[model samples]
Target: MQKYSTILLVGVVVILAATLAGVLVFMKNNPAQERALLPLVEIAPMEPDSAKWGVNFPSQWNSLQKTETNNIDTAYAGSSAFSWLERDPRQVILFAGYPFSKDYNDDRGHMNALEDVRATKRLNLNDEDPKRTPATCYSCKSSNNPGLWEEMGMAEYDAMSFNEMTPNINNAIGCSNCHEAGTMRLIVTNPALNEALEAQGKDWTTFTRQEMRTVVCANCHVEYYFDGPGKYLTFPWTNGTRVDQIISYYEEEGFSDWTYPEAGTPMLKAQHPEYEFFTAGSTHYNAGVSCADCHMPYVRDGAAKYSSHDVHSPLINPEQACGQCHTDVNYVVGRVATIQEQVAVTKIAAEDALIDAINAIQLAAANPNADAALLDQARALHRKAQFMWDFLSAENSTGFHNPEYALKICAEATNLARQAQMLAAQSVNDPSLLTTGTYYTTP
Candidate 1:
């Protein structure tokens, strides 16, 4: 019995030493050498099969699949589709000269990009000048963008027409859109964004992983406009990310996307600025919570761990998302609900103020001798007011991401808008008015 026990002990000691050595080697080699083994694969254009990329990075692909699930809903944004037009028909007058007036729905699943763009009234391919909307429109819609960039170069990618380029943009939003398959690292494939960041004297590559998580969403969720004949994608963050800064930038550039028929203001369209709002909020400001933290919480499947890429409300899985960071689930839920309620109330107030401002502008525009200066004042006020309303509405989770900051920004925006309207009205009432046309009426 003693002889047998001795032999067993010797075998155990040898196994333990070997295991320890193996662990040490793995730790030393993994941070650099192992990462190098993961080569960066440039995905081909219009690679419709997401599963192909899935084989490379199972985790990101698995998370992305959750986007297809339509189970979650919150006060505003969710997995389900919501009609912005039906919610507020006044948008028609606000966006009279834009395609968005005809049809614009709130964002749905990333998977729906191709279908939503196709179905929406924004793109009128049947028109004689289909090129009115350039191929640059597809920049945010799919993984195929990088592939096109590779094949035709950035200049050609921006210059192609939608009708001429639709076939190459068939792939919907997927893994390769945000991740470099070879390295499984996040990459900014949009040349426009790269140039914009560089112009701002910022290196996008230096962004922390947490920042990258939200930056990926910002690639599509921020306010942008096309520049020049190439339809070059551009973010109006030249002046700054703040409302005043962006407005100042546009004014300085003399940029006017369209003129509101009713308001008679050279109006600027505000696209969804989800990342901007979230970044300004308390959670992002204080805790540094990235979008992935709440929107794409982790899920455990057996022994494997993967992020839930549903990209919906954190409320849907509060236990996993909020509860992990917050000890009390009920408190977190209550906070989210309260912030949403406040957002809704503020949204309504801003919308009412905006509509009123629009009405005032239309009335003033009708006078043959209406003051161009006065009209400009009213238009500025309307723009400010509309911007505030759109900012709040665009925030998917209210101030849950940063309650204090979001509330303050919203309040400031609201006050500025109201002030703009008052100034416009004062100008309209003055006798020194010029250049007025027939008053436009809304249906």
Candidate 2:
């Protein structure tokens, strides 16, 4: 029995020594390797240059650089940066007095933002004019803004002219636009976003990581307008992000982007409202899916998994974008195609109705003997109807973000437009003025 106990003790000692030897070997070989993997360079707070951040995150930076050359075109929208005005000339009539009628193009990728804004034909470069393009125009086009806004405050920053701000803004949209430099956490970088969220009685700082993924996109992808002669950038989200709520906010403010030519109606133009449209009870949004879930899905590198920053249409790479949550990528892609096509058709119908309303309103406004009260009412309806239509039109998704909301907004626009046409005809007491397709028939 003493010899058996001695043998068991020897075996236990051998096992412990072997385990300790293995642990010592691991420590000797791996600590230096792990230290070498640490970030080589530290990032500054709100760093404008994404290249600097690239030292720590090469995969994300490399993918972001690809956005500069992404010229692929989808069935509806992609990174092609095609002319929205040329594709749909009805837009010319819709935005007769606005710069959008002169030069409106589809959106490109983030890397092209500064270049695209500089190249656009819409720039009112005459700093001498009170209506000259304010530096607020550069708000969404550069990564330099977060730093600038911190230094100058958004009010003073927005008060400067676009040309005055030109030399200051060198880089396009980059890491600083959406992230905190040190921690690399998502944040509400834009001051307008901070104020807008606060106005809604919601503290973005208290929001969960999942909510921030969607809210961070709202930094730029929202409906905003210049508040006064100062051209202060402001989001029209005080009342809410819904179409009706947005219109109510605009109505209360008595804001008008421009007066429609011939029609003489005060108009409101929608900037890209993807955040508003998607968060308004979209299925994915309600299901806790964020904008990044599909647009910038997780990708595996050699020894790491990171979210891809190559932002573009999910259709371009549905396998990675849609396949994370959905098993059948093909079916999901088909649904997007179907939803966009349906919305596109409905959008065109709304456009036609608005044009008919504009024709009738113009004729009524031109008539000296028209009923003043009825003519004014017709103009009001046209204003609301066109804004409702433009809300769906200006959004980048082509209605795929929220199909039901898109269709509903378009239907409301069409109905209001038809009512505007009727009121205009009644004001002038002319049945011929209520004709449909006046755009096609007028000349």
In terms of TM-score, the best-performing candidate is 2
TM-score of 2: 0.92
Candidate 1 C-alpha lDDT tens digits along 1-443:
99999999999999999999998897664534233345345544435468786665565567777676664667766777777778766566556778888887777788778877777768756525734777777888887777778778877887777777887777788876777655556777777777766777878789998889878777787777787767778887776676567678777877777778866777777777776666653545557787788777777655445677556677777899887688999986887788777866665555555655666666667766666786677677667656656665666555565566566666766665556555555665743322222122222
The alpha-carbon deviation from the true structure for residue 398 of candidate 2, after best TM-score superposition, in angstroms, is 1.0
Clashes of 2: 0
lDDT of 2 at 400: 91
Please give each candidate's TM-score. 0.84, 0.92
Error of 1 at 195 (Å): 1.6
Query: Residue 17 of candidate 1: its Cα lDDT?
Result: 97
How close is each model in CA RMSD to the real structure?
5.6, 4.6
Q: How many residue pairs clash in all the candidates, one count each?
A: 9, 0
